[model samples]
Target: MKKWLIYTFAIAILAVLALQLFMFSTIQQQKNSDEKYFNMAKQEYKIFVPYIPDSLELFGENVPVDHVLVRERLENEIVRNMYWHSHTILLLKRSARYFPVIEPILSENGIPDDFKYLAMAESELTNAVSPVGASGVWQFMKSTAQEYGLEVRTDVDERYHLEKSTNAACRYLKASKQQFGSWTLAAAAYNMGGGALKRDVDAQKTNDYYSLLLNQETARYVYRIVALKLICEQPFQYGFFIRNKDLYQPIPVKKVSVSSSISSLVDFAAEYNLSFLELKNVNPWLRSDKLVVNTGKTYEINIPLSFSHTKLTENIADPYTIFKDSIVVE
Candidate 1:
């Protein structure tokens, strides 16, 4: 019995020692892992604050970046867009495809070319719908779109029509400019309605957009546009390093005019050697699967031109360089 007790005590001591050794080993391994992780983090990780340009302008109006509040507001947008890699990268790619379409329309309307960035600010150059029922790249509400000559019907919403919406936006901006007497104020009025903006101006006794205390969204509106303008104009300087080939190329398309209704877009697409998805992609303005044309109305459906992958690749080039001559910089 004494031998048994002695043996059991010896076994218990061995078990405790084993457990202690195992725990020590585990603690040592964790310490080494932590040390390695700290070393790697110290060597490799970095976050950078972007440089702010001394001078900035939007639509020929000098942004009051000299003012501390103005500078900080602009910096906030720049930093947000700069660090937001996915969103900004997509913006760059999409701008390559859509800017070519928007620039000409703005020019023809005698609107400042800088307003293209306003469209970017509005919808990221996409046919986006807002929560309050504003739709399109310009984010025009139904009444506003119709007022500006867009057809916002049950079957057809031209707000999604890129060219037409851009034209409508141009008209609106021009009218806003006339009402406000400055492009900056016009941009502000575009975000908050003209009536609301005018009320704010009168209440504050200030015609200056920067000076007038306004709603949060309206206050930040122009700054966002200016920030986008700066980054788009100098993407590389802002740390976006998109290659020419990486940029989205504008799809080649031909217009098919139809005075009559299209009974089935699927059939219509097949007639043009396209899939329904492809047809819809090119013509998002076509709301319904079918079209109804009144006696005097006509619609133009865009049909993408067929090209081999090699041929398409051969046409890929830097949009900035290609459209540089066309872009009017003030």
Candidate 2:
């Protein structure tokens, strides 16, 4: 009986040791599997530093990227925009829709094509209103809008008028360029007001935007614009791979001139087989539900071509062919 009991005890000890060995082997296998996946994951996802071009320009002015500070600032902007995937991608899409409208106006006004990027920096190509009462895609203050010949009033605020506001921006930028003698300084002035920028230039005894010490926002403004220009011009380089059809195409519109008042915009929209929302979407400058037209004054309202009396058998071709030419592959 004693021998049998000792044998049973020995067997029990062996079983416990075998169980521990199996558990340890299983744990080691799990650890190896986890390590394998971890290494694979590390290989799959990568974060890369944005590439910096050795040479860059804005508005025909050579950016002094050779300077350490300037290069650093430019890098800061590139990193910010590149990592900010959502906002940057949306800007890319919206630029396709809006740049076509803005480009011709800039050309007519003798503004450089690069200035459109400034507008993108300002409002992301949306009819945005700043907290300080600055409104529109150009982000014009009421006084500035008025000074630039934009009609800002209760019934009609032309600050939200894309074409008119773009014209106004051209006038302002031109005047600033004349005063500051550099597009870079003019862009700085656009952000930090002409008066303030003038004071900084005078106090520093330098008109070079790169040399002058500016407030934080104004300091980053031009760099941000240039960064946007670079990324947008070569989105593929910055890792933005967007399909052409995914871009927002410009909507075709037919202008309707109304010399008389529109008592009920909803009723007027219905007359043209459009929703009130559609009418307002196209004519955001129309402030109220009704439009008040003064004597001898006419408002040219844009109606989507599809909604207008014109017959359309198919969808319009892409109006943003510039993207095809501008995209850079590296």
Candidate 3:
């Protein structure tokens, strides 16, 4: 009996050891698998690339990095914009389409090239509407847009119209530059009202935008613009990479004059071989599917002759898919 009991006990102990060995092997295999996946995922995602320059310029005006606060402010902006990758990437992609339109307009109006950065800072180079009803790439408040000759109405909101709004922005910038005597101050005024900027300058006894101790948004405004300018110009340097195929392209469109109401934009788009959704996509200022025209007032409607790859229909499997040369509508 004692011998039988010893045999049973020994066998049970060996079985327990075998079970433990099996579990150990399984657990180790799982750990190895996890490590492999972790390494793969790590290779896919990168983090924290920023290039903080010692000095920078905007419209031929230099940021005096010699000042500790100014240098620190710039450093803050560089880090903020660089790591905030998603927003910055969208802005970069949109720049391919919008910058061509904005550049020529800026040059034509005698506005400094650096002012394009200001527009980017204002509205991310998009027709983004603000919390307080400021609209468009320029973030024009309805009142201010009207003051600059942008017609704001229920039916026709020109603030959302890119070219018209840009012209208005140039006029406003020119006026502000005349008032402030410096591009820096002019940009600062754009954010926190010319009156507020003037008050701050007078109170602080300085005309410099950086020197004036202002509110947070106004304070960081110039630094943000300058940082964006640097990162966008050298996107690869800051670890932002979009393949040429993935970048958004502008659609080629011809101007169509309309002196009559468009009762149904759906029908109007079909006439031009465009989708209703796409019509709004390019002409965002068209608030509704209908347009009511007044006598003697001719509205220029931009009818796209070609489609860009931005339209992501299921049939359009290729991300690089884009229409060839557009036919200009006479």
Best by lDDT: 2
Q: Evaluated with TM-score, which candidate comes out highest?
A: 1
Model 1 C-alpha lDDT versus the unseen true structure:
0.85
Clashing pairs in 3: none
Please, what is the TM-score per model?
Answer: 0.82, 0.81, 0.79
lDDT of 2 by residue, 42-135 (tens): 5645568888878888999999898999999999999999989899999998997899999999999999999999999999999898989889
Q: What is the C-alpha local distance difference test score of each model?
A: 0.85, 0.86, 0.82
Q: Which has the better lDDT: candidate 1, or candidate 2?
A: 2
Q: What digit string (tens of lDDT, one per residue) describes model 3 on residues 228-321?
A: 8888787766766443444567777888999999999999999988889978877888888799998988889898866745452223333322
In Å, residue 196's CA in model 1 sits off its true spot by 0.7
Evaluation by TM-score, superior candidate among 2 and 3? 2
RMSD of 3: 10.2
**How many clashes (backbone N, Cα, C below 3 Å) per candidate?**
0, 0, 0
What is the alpha-carbon lDDT of model 3 when measured against the actual structure? 0.82
Worst 10 residues of 1 by lDDT: 321-330
